[model samples]
Target: MSDPVLVIGAGVAGMTAAVELADNGVQVVLVDRKSTIGGNALNLYKAFPTDDCFYCFEGNRWRPGIRKCFYRSAMIDQPNIELMTNTIIQDISGTPSKFTVKLVIGPQYVDPKKCIMCGLCVEVSEAFALESPQCQPQAVTYDPSKLDEGAKKAEQDCPTKAISLDANPSEKTITVSDIVLATGYHEMQPVAVDEYGYGVLQNVITQLELARILDPNGPLGGRLVRPSDGREAKRIMMIQCVGSRDENYYPFCSKICCVFALKHANIIANERADGRVSVVYMDIRTYDRHERYYREAREAGVEFVRGRISRVVSTEDDTLEITVYDSLLDKYLRFSIDLLVLSSALEPPEGLDEIIKTLGLKTASGYVGPADAASEDEVVVGEHVYACGGVLGPAEIPESVNQARAVVSKILQGRK
Candidate 1:
């Protein structure tokens, strides 16, 4: 019997679709290039609109019977689902009902069957520890090039000898009835936007990097300190649409940058209470029920500057000096800030061009658009292939999950 469905890119969107299908007695093959499932989500500290915690977790880590995070464990526990990590989809052939996919599966470093979650290896060599939260299989791969005396000691200390120095990658094929392409997105490089002085200014960082700074498990331990110096950011300036909504670079609106900057401003207000946070944007784009966030942000003393930044220059003191053309005031204003955060644009995930060309899908603004968005109002790219999340276009967490479920509904309805 052939597998019921193949879900590519195991992010939240793909995970939701896989779980829904498997729960309804459909066999699913979830594949991703990363060792972990959560995509851009891992880089985020809090989501927009409600600003809820990004990764929902409960119970103690040491407890044996404690309930684990649903997103982290559900797919692994589901008997009908096969979680394949470190996989590369080389080819996709055939059509609607019987799709043949060629895959190159790479080793996970350690043998999952023999290894227990003992911290022996991690303690021996800190390099063995993976940075990702809720990593599936929970084993670190051994790299011969990076190995040292500590890694050798850990290998000898392993009771099960699950650490393998030589593991060969292999090729395989899986046939599935349906294919859902939920490949998320990649942050457009900020260096492309010249005016923002991304590469020129030392204190400048992207919005995604700001999210990492806010994350408790991030490099700074969630302290929100300036990269140039270990000082708390007292005067922070967030410039929106650095690479987005620009004629020179990406001309499309990145939908989420406006509100994403707003959320960060709110966090700074709450954290410091007196932290001077200013957002420089062409215009705010909080629509529908999320308007409350805008109101709350204003109430919390987050300054919204209506303008476009002309240039950012680095000072001799290692600070950033921003020159903005304020639309509201009809004048240029110069300000010095400790940190300059760029709200960069979101682009399609890497290698999506090959998949798009191979599948013969339509593109909108360099993104995978629906085959018939006007009539179908769906992300259906081809007969049996569908696209969602950031792959379809730049989408937030809520929109991506919603679109994923909608695609599954259409898939299941067709089966009926």
Candidate 2:
């Protein structure tokens, strides 16, 4: 068979490249190990303050539309783009100009085309006591752990028999002219740090966990509560840069965390009349366009403390005692709060090293493949192999999409 232009990852960058290449008159095959295309951003409950109330809605802010996600739906539906999900590239060989790809595609019992978004599968699974809160209702694969209590009952309850605990597919090999790798960054597990007592402290939560709590469709139904006690929290303290900008940890500042903390604080204060929230940070990097967001947050009465937190220890009353050296006041201070939120640093996602090795791609920082010789800091996209989005480096949605477009130009130009 003739070689098609291959794009690895179904994230915004990969999908965008696929559509752009197809539009430019190239046969393309977009491959992803995941069943869905949205990537890490899709796991997000809402787009900060823009998506109505993150804590109040499961469906999109405006209902069924591709714009609901950061990557629009139309990008995937493009005629020239062929999306292959639940598939991983097992091997790649030949020069960058032309290559062979061996892929392993797993089975998804529920065919996306055949299943309407009616959510009957969820209802049936729940009736059989095999429902998982962590599982997305729209997700193609069902978690077997959810069926542990009554696997027999759940099996009978499945009207479509679409729940597959074990679904394997035959491996196949194909050829491609070029490849684009765009696997994105991963969320750091706050529990790994250990200083904040993440796993031990029930009321202590990570920023992502806070997002889940604020999500109306989440396990907490949007009420900010103490995880251990299930009581609505009146006072919340968000600790910024928990794993970021430290000599011991990641020395660089995670750019978006400050704004995220400010946004979260503003949202919580606005929702609850008596809500008191404070953000503890060494420096606030509202450096450019984000300065306005910081200004608005201050105007909304959210407290920003310029201090470095020393420790977070639980008190006898189950409240968290936060110790910080307030640089502004030149004094040490302590605050007790019902909830302690850790603005954990983001890291590159798992399986990237293996993927890099499999594809013979270079890497740095123990996560993603390294950048080009011209630009040592940025991930280098070879003439025939391209990379875009967070896999290249940390960036917001706009920057991510822009990188994708740049890759498209590179690929098209190479073709000529």
Among these predicted structures, which one has the highest lDDT? 1
Candidate 1 global CA lDDT score: 0.80
lDDT of 2 at 390: 72
What TM value does model 2 have? 0.84
User: Model 1 TM-score?
Assistant: 0.91
Cα-based lDDT for every prediction: 0.80, 0.69
Please write out the lDDT profile of model 2 over residues 266-303, one tens digit for every residue: 77888776788988888888667777768877887878
lDDT of 1 by residue, 1-416 (tens): 54579999888788878877887788999999877677787678888644655566331234344354565577778898998888989999987789899988986567766777576887887547655445565565555567667887887898889876557888989888888998888888788677777877768989989899887778778887888877887889998887788788789988888778888888888876468888998878876677777888899888888988887888887788888889999999999898999999887778999988988989888888888878665678888888778888888888888888888888888787
Which candidate comes out best when scored by TM-score?
1
Cα lDDT, model 1, residue 274: 62
**TM-scores of the models, in the order given:** 0.91, 0.84
- Lowest summed lDDT across 10 adjacent residues in model 2 is found at 128-137
Which residue runs does candidate 2 get wrong by more than 4 Å?
Answer: 48-72, 124-140, 149-157, 164-166, 358-380
Off by over 4 Å in 1: 57-68, 112-119, 123-126, 141-147
